[model samples]
Target chain A: MDTDLARERILDAAEDLFYARGIQAVGMDAVRDAAGVTLRRMYQLFPSKGDLVEAYLARRDARWLDSLATHVDTVGPTAQARVLAVFDWLEDWFARPDFHGCAFINSFGELAGTSPQVTAAARHHKDAFHAYLHQLTTAAGATAATGAQIALLAEGAMTTAAISGTPAPARHAKAAALNLLTLDARPVASPA
Target chain B: MDTDLARERILDAAEDLFYARGIQAVGMDAVRDAAGVTLRRMYQLFPSKGDLVEAYLARRDARWLDSLATHVDTVGPTAQARVLAVFDWLEDWFARPDFHGCAFINSFGELAGTSPQVTAAARHHKDAFHAYLHQLTTAAGATAATGAQIALLAEGAMTTAAISGTPAPARHAKAAALNLLTLDARPVASPA
Candidate 1:
């Protein structure tokens, strides 16, 4: 296989293991085994386990942000719908059998403050989310304070949904987004 | 120290280590050292590391549930206020320097399918949160479906807040809770 293919294979194996188990629990040996590659080839592809872990998180983060941007763009110009669209996406995402909670948060929890790469990746995702929410809320004609409030609500709803193991968090978030819409006299979409 | 104090010390150390570091990363020796107890005492108090972990989680679960119940009771007869109280509590809890995300969720992420004790604790806490939300929503006169919806929003909010590394999740949850109150024709409380 080409080096590119080998790299992709290693990353795929790492992502599966990391997400399924955790970054800490899975070892380089397991990654090599899962990828059907020799230890020498694994080392050639990535200098260290941390580098592989960083690459895994980076790939996941990019995909998440890309998906978020796409979802926002696909939803019509209505801010409320856009906000709701995000949660709708999350509901589907979490329902999968392999569903774990947010990867960035999980990484942060596992690594604690030990890894700068992990922390930076987690922070980047979070900042991107807040910025996206801010833009959407602002587009909806909410004041800075109101937009902040709406964004905060969206953030909280996501956390609750992950921990509480119920769909209520998403539902409440949609309702809250609708409420924000109504506060500014914008037409609200019916909850799907 | 007395048996009760010894137990408390072990739990305290476990909670500190477990929260500061991943469960898998902290060995029994470290826990023993942190607690200022011998290995024999640690094993004697809790027959296994798994038992210690479960006991630690159980303690946190009880404390959190108690706090939730107290907050619900303290809020006036309005479902909206009761719902808001949940996030209010979360905001306060998360503000603490030691505040990491939910321990149950963290443990679940670490153990995932590998450890039965961790999974059970995570599921138990999750179920309890759902049941509590359901009861509160129902008491607030929401239809069964609406209550479930609100509960989902709450769950999502909590997860997102933890992931996003912003208190916004809890704030968003409060707003969503307020919206639910409006829908249910209950009085809304001031934001915390």
Candidate 2:
């Protein structure tokens, strides 16, 4: 197998297995078998399980963010609409049969206590996500704080939707975000 | 050892171990060792690992909800204050040294895919929590939809605070909850 192709195949299997069945539950041998790569080739591509896990998360982080941003760019027309569009994107995601939850949140919950690499990866993913929301809210003439609050609604919707097995939280969160935007954009009155 | 005490000890240890390390990473042997019970006693009490996990989550659900209610009742003098008190309770929880996020969220992330018991337990916990918030919001003269939106803020705060290792999300969530309450309670003007 070509080295790059073998690497991608390995990561693809690893991501699917890890996301579906928690990280500790899936072994490197399972990943090799699923990827159709020999143990020797798998080891060569990722020397250790830790290295493989890190690569899986790093790739996922990039891919997930890119997908969200692309959707936002495609559908969101104005600053406020862009913010609400995130929840629309989330509703679609939550409705998918394969949707579990936020990979970063799930990964952190499953491994952050024992794995610092996992902790850093989860933190970095969220920081980047929060920053993206802040930029959107800033463009909408809202405070950074409002941006953080909006981000909370999005985060909440993901977990809630995943656990409840419904996409309704996304709608609730979008409504809340709209209300926050309206309230935050209100002009402060000068003393009479 | 008394059966009831042994069960409690086992659950206490299991909860700590499972929360500190992911559930799959901590075996029944580790739980027995941590609880200082014999293998025979442990098996006699829990029957299986699944049973132990269920018991841990069940006890946690009751206790966690009770803790939130107790705090809310003590600090919240009015309906609006009661609703915001939920966030304050979350802030204190996030600040705890051993805080690892919502147990149900973590457990669902770790085991819900494979364990029906875990899936049900997670769903039940979240349902009960959302219902409690709905009750509070209704008392505060907000619509059920507004109640759900506020619940999303609390849910988001838990996940964010866990990943970021900061209690600040609780404050952000509290502020957002306040805004939601205000917006939700506004009386619609009759046609003039």
For lDDT, the strongest prediction is 2
Q: For residue B142, what is the lDDT in candidate 2?
A: 95
lDDT of 1 by residue, A60-138 (tens): 9888878877877888887667766876776666666676677877777677546778877877877787688778777
Candidate 2 chain B: 10-residue stretch with minimal lDDT: B183-192
lDDT of each: 0.73, 0.91
For model 2, the superposed segments whose C-alpha errors exceed 4 Å read: A187-192, B187-192
lDDT per residue, candidate 2, A1-192, as tens digits? 799999999999999999988788788889989999999999887889999999999999999899989999996469998888889999999999989998888888888888999999999999999999999999999999999999999999999999999999999999999989988876323334
Question: DockQ for each candidate?
Answer: 0.34, 0.62
Best by DockQ: 2
Q: Score candidate 1 by DockQ.
A: 0.34
